[model samples]
Target: MDDVKQNVQKVPKRKGLSNKGQENFWGYVFIMPNLIGFTVFTLFGIVFSLIMAFTNWNLMKGLDKVQFVGLDNFRSMIGDAYLSASLRNNLILLIVVPITLFLAAILAVVMNRNVYWKSGARALYFLPYITNTVAVSTVWQALLHQTKGPINSLIARIFNLPMKQTPGWLSSSKWVLPALIIILIWQALGYDILMYSSALQSIPADYFEAAEIDGANAIQRFFYITVPLLSPMTFLLMILGVIGSLQMWSFVQLVTKGGPGTASYTIGLYIYRSGFQTYRTGYACALSWLLCAFILVLTLIQWNGQKRFSID
Candidate 1:
């Protein structure tokens, strides 16, 4: 009887293993196309770039003509004054993200307060984010033109400021990054508004009702109830904002081209220049790796801070 029981258990265990294997095989088969593409495109390129970072190569030089310079590319990046300035611009991007989010949240709250045409307000806000980046940059470039732009005209009227043709926005050293920030904020405000509005919708109505019954003022409810519940969404926005800032390049490319002596330059623009403009492919790879490392470190810090704060 004991032998018979052991045999029964063995048969069932073997059948279970066979079934599990078959399921896993099907799963692998289903995802194999994606896996193969990812490995070929992303993984291979990453590995290739890693290898290239240690060498020096250009179009003029053939592949085998590459020279191994170990950490020299890294050393070059440290000493490169342009790169330092670009990093500052990148940091400015980080600053813009949260400010944009805050503005969006305020706008969203007001719009979503059951005001008429709430959907229209939402659409208007999101429109800028979905607009063509190049077109927006061009429009901004025109608006910030020194002589005839609306912004300078407004400034002249409000503050009685001496216009003095206000320097060409993208050309001016002091204002290029700031100008870019303004455009970025304008472009992204809508997306953040939509996200915060969605989050507000997801929040249960009970909290607000109870607060209303307690004779809570709008300010009190916003602080004690809305803010606490919205923390996680804000936290997510923070991370994405930082990442977007770190990867920022399009507007710079469209407007400044890292011009006026690299004032409004960023790491993404730097990498693009090294690879495409300068034809220093290997050096570009090194620059990319450094950028990747910088982003990784900063992102890790932000992520850790979020977890510690228990934003979720």
Candidate 2:
């Protein structure tokens, strides 16, 4: 009876599946749901949009009414005044990437040193990035008010100038883009700083020590050793910043709605207006493809250029 019980306990292995094969099979099983979801939603949507770009399809009209109009939507883009203005604005906004990265680099250097309330300072800076976009825009809207806003009020008091002489931030086309740029920079600074600070920690102290022993000043050490080492992070932030700036629409939509004669219109805002407001689905799809192409080209350029500057 004991021998029979022991033999029964020795179960046979599977006929074909090895341990690794079993693991891979189970892994695929676990991921099957997500894979299906991506296929049904993301992948399908992408392919569908690409096809729709070549056809005149109005949402209001039935699917059977989709008219084939190859290249017409693409051609229409050349004469689109709104698209031109929005693209120009997006190009202008690209300046935010470099400026924000520069400031973040400087601040990261300062914070990496012995500083007061370091954790609190970092949290305060990061707060804006994690905050709700609508809420942030709302707060900025009030702060940037032409007359009653604290910013203009402070300027008026500091310069002892009348309110009329103070710059109209959101209200005037001349200052709207600049105001938006300032807000973008402030919002993005914290994330960049965090990334920089983390990168700074990884750098060996020996590098700085050697530089110090060699009689190198703070700025010289920063430029020579620090800058080169941090080049990879800089490249990463530059790519992300440029992409974010180009796709920026929420702030413009919430604050100015591309008003003051499309002074602050961005490609994203134009796309939204075309698709939702005007219901020009085909044209919107075409425009989005163009934007995608632009981003891809720019990213490729940056990727190729990074070899020249990146340390690793």
Candidate 1, residue 35: Cα displacement in angstroms equals 1.4
lDDT digits (tens) for residues 25-62 of candidate 1: 77999999999999998999899899999998775668
Candidate 2, 1-312: lDDT as tens digits: 999867755645465666567778889999999999999999998998999999887877788999889999999999788999998889988998999899999999989987999989999999999987898889998998989999999999999999998988988989988998999888999999999999999999999999999999999999999888999899999998888787887778987899788899988998888888888888888888998998999999999899765644
Q: Model 1, residue 293: displacement in angstroms?
A: 1.6
Per-candidate TM vs. native?
0.88, 0.92
- In candidate 1, which residue pairs clash? none
Candidate 1 displacement at residue 278 in angstroms:
0.7
* Candidate 1 RMSD to the correct structure: 4.7
- lDDT for model 1 comes to 0.84
Residue 248, candidate 1: Cα error in Å is 1.0
Output the lDDT of residue 195, model 1: 88
Backbone clashes for every candidate come to: 0, 0
Residue 278, model 1, lDDT: 85
* Model 1 quality (TM-score): 0.88
